[model samples]
Target: MKLQTALRLIYPPRCVSCGDLVESDFGLCGPCWRETPFIEGLACDTCGVPLPGHSDQIEHCDDCMRIARPWSRGRAVLTYKDNGRKLVLALKHSDRLDIIRPAGVWLARAARPILQDQMLIAPIPLHWSRLLKRRFNQSALLAQELGRLTALSVCPDLLVRPKRTESLEGKGHDARFTTLDRAINAHPKRKHRMAGRHVLLIDDVMTSGATMAAAAEACLSAGAHDVSALSLARVAKDA
Candidate 1:
């Protein structure tokens, strides 16, 4: 038997979320897949939140309309609820490196509409202290995988977080934005990469979009022609 097939026989592919044996690798089982709220049809153009009804014209969600988004466009693979939340948490805190493959594929599909020719792929930067604690940046991993799948140029350190901000957990919307303001900046040595190019920022989740706003603003300050964002999950109020 082939070595690969032998390995599969020894250790069957399992669902990323529930650990149930699945038919294929890097995917969820049928139950978990159904529970995961994949965003589809009539999503907000600015934030990728699922909106009611269908429309051909560009539309923005209420939150996006109220808040200023520095990025021109955005997309997200799943709504932050049920299995979606579980997947994001696993990737972010559980050291679930296995989730990167499926996430990259989903992110690439979501990003297709906003993709521009010769665009640069980057991830939201984590503070040095947090990086030390976590040992890895999930966003960076996702960005690298996404670049591999899309054949785009990936700059892992394109952005930097000079100021360490407290966790946004349990913080109000205004507080979240206040804490992240002016916290992120373009890396001095790599700032040239952003000049005159369309940059795509990747993140594991979009909560209040405060972090994305800061990162997008940094890219714009460094002379990026445009900034776009893609996330594995988006935290929507109704979801």
Candidate 2:
């Protein structure tokens, strides 16, 4: 028997969410897949939130219209609820590295609409202290996987968080932005790679978009030609 087939038979592929046996790796079973809120149809051009009805022209959600998004465009793979939420949490906290493969695939699909030539993939930075606690940055993992799938260059440390900000959880929208403001900056040594290049920022989840805005601003200030964002999941208000 072939080595690949032997391995599969010995250790069957399992669902990423419910841990049930599945036909393929890094996938969800039927029930879990159905429960997952994969974003589809018409969505905001800036935030990737699903909007009512359809339009040929680009659309923006109320939040995206009201808030200042430093990135030129954005997309998300899933709505932050149900199985989507579970997948993000698993990757972020449970050390579920297996999810990266499926996430990269989904992110690649969502990113197709906004992809630019010679795009540089980078991840939202985590404070050094936080990085020490977590051992790894989930965003960095996602960015690396995305770069591999898309055949783009990945700069895992393109951005840095010199200062650690408190958690944005439970904080109001304005406060979240205020807390993250000026907190993210481009790495001085790596700024040369970002100059005059289009940058795509990756993150595990986007809530108020405060973190993405800060990272995008940092890239722009560092002389990036343009900035765009891709998140694994977006915390939609109605979701």
Candidate 2 residues lying further than 4 Å off, grouped into runs, are none
Q: Please provide, for model 2 over 27-75, each residue's C-alpha lDDT reduced to its tens digit, 9 standing for 90 to 100.
A: 9999998999999999999988888998999999999888778888999
- lDDT, candidates in the order shown: 0.94, 0.94
Clashes of each: 0, 0
Determine which window of 10 residues in candidate 2 has minimal summed lDDT.
63-72
Clashing pairs in 2: none
Q: By TM-score, how accurate is candidate 2?
A: 0.98
On residues 22-132, what C-alpha lDDT tens digit does candidate 1 reach at each position?
999998899988899999998999989889999999999999999889999999999999889989999888999999999999999999899977999999999999999
Give per-residue lDDT, candidate 1, residue 74.
Answer: 94
- After TM-score superposition, the amount by which residue 138's alpha carbon in candidate 1 deviates from its true location, in angstroms, is 0.3
